[model samples]
Target chain A: MSEQQTVGFTVNGERHTVSVPTRELLVHTLRERLHLTGTHIGCDSSHCGACTVDLNGRSVKSCTVLTVQAQNAEVLTVEGLAGPDGLHPLQEGFREEHGLQCGFCTPGMLVRAYRFLQENPDPDEDQIRTGMAGNLCRCTGYQNIVKAIRYAAEKQTAGSV
Target chain B: MIPPSFAYRAPASLKEALALIDESGDDAKFLAGGHSLLPMMKFRVSEPAVLIDLGGVPELQGIREAGDRIHIGPMSTENEIIGSALLQQKCPLLPEVARWIADPQVRNRGTIGGDVAHGDPANDHPAVMLALEADFVLRSSQGERVVPANEFYFGTYFTAMEANEVLAEIRVPVLGPGTGYAYKKLKRKTGDFAIAAACVLLTLDRGICKRIAITLTNVGPTPLRASAAEQALTGKAIDDAAVENAAQLAMQICDPAEDLRGDKEYKTHMAGEMVRRAIRQALERAKEAK
Candidate 1:
């Protein structure tokens, strides 16, 4: 016997209402119920950033958060990063910089970097490294990943100007 | 890993939450930021039958000033504390320590109230609160009562808070002029728990210490206040010799258990080393404080 609850939240600017078990994590809801597989779940313990998402403008590990906790909150996953016009700057940067391999952690890394760039539009290399330390990548050694974020940062800065 | 099934209640108000806690009794647990509790739940280390979610309760949120003290809402997340301009100016030490907590994602959801109430010696806030001489306001059906930070922590995963009460607010006396504070944590990695950490808060009058508080983290069953060290530094110049002696005194109170971070001896030595560093940095900051 499992208790369930109805949770209403906004995802990628669209409203979602779902009934989930009380123990259902936001990552499971996003991937299983909502069918948004872009938000991967690597470390369910929340130590790994494979489930990172923007919850009400702040990055949070979705695996560690209950689905009910997102009630009425605005959540942004990796799938929401791009626009109708084209790929988001972060997406393009990752592509241009070859920022990933195996790509298991790319979705989370991209989503996390997307929010990171928003918080710090013109971060230096060290600042970027520190800011994105939460997200882990098994491949690429983080050198190119850092460059990818920097690439997006520069492009975004230019676009804003 | 899915957590054990539990009934969830998002109470609309603090009063409702308190009432729910009372009705549920020992089977209930107040869900704060969910960072600490959820992880434990996932591990099956905790299996509360009822979780009273405080998400919708507005009364348990915010950072405000009340006369001589600053009130930090129990639901205020670590990132909120790190970003609070008032706290940054009035009590910079909190923001400084908040930055060292886990990482961006964890900080976004980890509440200071949860960190302190969890009673984990490695959580950082308990020792920091002790050094700051903060107080916690607990709410229950009976009423509310304030518990000093030093007296609140009991043992690992234990606190003075009653089962029917929720930590409503944290009351910290606003650090005034001539006060210096620092939290020196020695963690193995970026988001790892501290091997040994020291939190130092001191008030300086000219070159002499008017008051000093030294506390150690992850070196005992609970956050250990270095009373002997604090007493030694009181009314004395914060020179290298004074800091050295105080650090040694602080080391004497450590009762650390061996963990992956290090052996007991290494943790004890790191406790003293961190205290020395924290005291020196606090003194530097104190001298600059207007």
Candidate 2:
């Protein structure tokens, strides 16, 4: 929707004032303008879930959201999951559990799983499956991703302890 | 997957959004949560010259229960509906339907208002709303009017909604005593669209149906109510024989088109089976409520 003016939003705690046409998707905005290529665009059609990100406080398919529509909204991409020289617990869990094979869908999966644990920290196997159903991973059977969430759960709880 | 270039305007109020739509005429489209419209826009399936964002319009969000009806604002997210205490207490059927909509992520962004106004027969809530005899409140620069759910949908991606109008709220009647409801869906995966779906709402008097409403989804250009099946169930005990007859009649009434999900025959048979299962579950739900 590039009709008249430019818009801006907060991404990964950074204020990004990018000039976008009124209809530019947030996924493209995060990838192209901001140079945060961590958010991949696999299937722009709300399917595939390759562009998953936390918008405001919830996980959402970035490809389906217009950049202008996200103006003044809080966006958390895959790049935002880490902090000074360390990985997020979900990232560590995926690495330790060998959750990636081809790694094409890893970013979205990681981000989605990150939010999944936040939404449901003590999720069971079935809960994890239902929670992350929107984010598909064809490369892996998700046996390990389920394990990864479990691993993160234990670590997160233990860390808090 | 960049959406084709279009001018964007985020309106501060319903009045402003409507005025923009009026000024831009047919070249403008309202973006409410943008779960459905933005995807279509990125695909170039719908390329409006201007995108009028409705997020700033404060009046278009929330759920309120008054008298015997539940009024849902146009911008209420599926998650919001699921979490709504008012709807959960009065119209539990809505939250049950909300739980299975798309996936958790899509549910966070997608609004029921957008879903109803989009008029996609394949979507779940339209059929659920129709089965509940929901009424849609439409507003424009002119004023506001209410259209019953059955009359709202016209055809594929079509509604009685005018180009300059916005759906203000959806009003659904709260079920009285002796009501039961169930929604049955068969999908390839958790997040995938439904292959076939069934929504049933029945009111029983001493274990015999006093009234029945059955609706089929993703099978036609509109959410179809199986009038013949409803007629068969009403004033009859919901026994095995009656359920079977009603299910079969509902299946017969449906002329499902062959899609990627299944052949027409398969969808038709599944529709019948879904009705049977939904009726059984709905009876149980009604029993629990009592």
CA deviation > 4 Å runs, candidate 2? A1-4
DockQ (model 1, Cα)? 0.88
- Stretches off by above 4 angstroms in model 1 are none
Error of 1 at A15 (Å): 3.1
State the iRMSD of every prediction, in order shown: 0.7, 2.1
Model 1's number of clashes is 0
Cα misplacement distance, residue A20 of candidate 1 (Å)? 1.3
Checking candidate 1 for backbone clashes, the offending pairs are: none
Error of 1 at B169 (Å): 1.0
Candidate 1, A1-161: lDDT as tens digits: 89989999999999999999999999999999999999998978777799999998989999999998888999999989899989999999999999998898999899889888889999999999999989888889999999999999999999999
A56-156, model 2: which lDDT tens digit per residue? 88998988887767768899999998889699888899999998888888999988988888888889999998888888888789999899889988888
**Residue-level lDDT tens digits of model 2 in B1-290:** 66788777778988988989999978888888787787677678998887888888988987888889988888999999999988878888889988878888898888998877888877899999889999888899999998999888888888899999999989998877568889999888776677889999987777778878899988887888999998988898888998899999988877777878898889889889889999999888777767
